[model samples]
Target: MVTVKMLKPYYIKADNDFIRVILAYQYFSVLIDEQVYQFVPTEAKEIRINRRTQKVENMGVRFAFQKGKDIAYLTMSELISLPDFLLQLDTIAQPYYFQEKTNQKNETAIIIRELEQLNLRRLIDKSLDERDADTFHSLTKML
Candidate 1:
């Protein structure tokens, strides 16, 4: 039987589309039949998770564990059965999602403010060209 002993990511990277969990050397350990094994990335590969579906991408990521003179790879099925690992990953990814939402809101607010200013400038220009002192004065007061 396989059981997860510890699964702590070194750092997490998040964007609008995906969240990546990066593991440092010897950071992730598991137990197979009461024997402990530390899984290491074959390359600088990270576990990619889709933000929308909250599932592992599992396309190009590879992890290997040394078993004496032989090396074995951790399979996708083993990863999927670990509910605690998934929960921890989600907890770490949640803050990034919140920050992304906050940033998007700030960007939207800035755009709205800029559009409002442009509209006001156009109105002021039109009022000045039409020789309407009352309209121009009202628009200038908005500044």
Candidate 2:
């Protein structure tokens, strides 16, 4: 029996349409019976995923799996039976997606704070121009 294990990608890049997993240096592994086969990327091959559907797009992409001197290329049929693996990969890539959202939130917060400060400064200026000592003091204290 074949059991897939240690299926990791070196890097995951996500965009609006797709998530690409760049494979490198023993990033994927599978166990066939008792032997552990490590699949290493020999050329430029990436697992392209549809961002909305979360489905693997490059089903024909193959990786050469090696166990000591024994080596073989994984077949398309075998690659097709990997929905669970893709789900695991999605979990691994979740933090990267969340990180982008977090950065956007932080940027929005910074802009809002800057606008509030600017408004307060304008109020302070108006109080100075009108010679309103109480309003000027209150606005400056808000700074």
Candidate 3:
């Protein structure tokens, strides 16, 4: 029954390596009539947890981002483009650990290795070498 209505722009932060992001200031699947949840990124430092009154706009939601020393209102665009995500953002309360997709790098490695076996990497390398050779060669010439 989950539809685009449930997708909304919820703020999320990039992980340590900037590979993935955790949804910011939102919650989902509560039991009580007014139960809520807030999720904090395990790796978040400057803004581990934020509290604010987010401003809603046609584009999406906006809110103040506050940690101990950092304070600003950040906007998340894509998910806000969806509806469902917005519903939860308006509803959830209290902080919780944002459950994120696990085993990312290991799985990424497997996929990359599979592509390499199929020679896709070499093809990409050729394209890069051809297109970027002028730039690289220019640097060499300068050296």
Clashes of each: 0, 0, 19
- Can you write out model 1's per-residue Cα lDDT over 12-82, one digit (the tens) per residue? 88887888888876777777778877776775357787776666887544567665766667666566667
Worst 10 residues of 2 by lDDT: 93-102
TM-score of each: 0.57, 0.57, 0.21
Tell me the whole-model lDDT of each prediction, alpha carbons only. 0.75, 0.75, 0.39
| Candidate 3, residue 73: lDDT | 38
- Candidate 3 local lDDT, 3-22, one digit each (tens): 22221224454333321223
Which of the two candidates, 1 or 3, achieves a greater lDDT against the reference?
1
Worst 10 residues of 1 by lDDT: 93-102
Which candidate order results from sorting by lDDT in descending order? 2, 1, 3
1 or 3, greater by TM-score: 1
What is candidate 2's TM-score against the reference?
Answer: 0.57
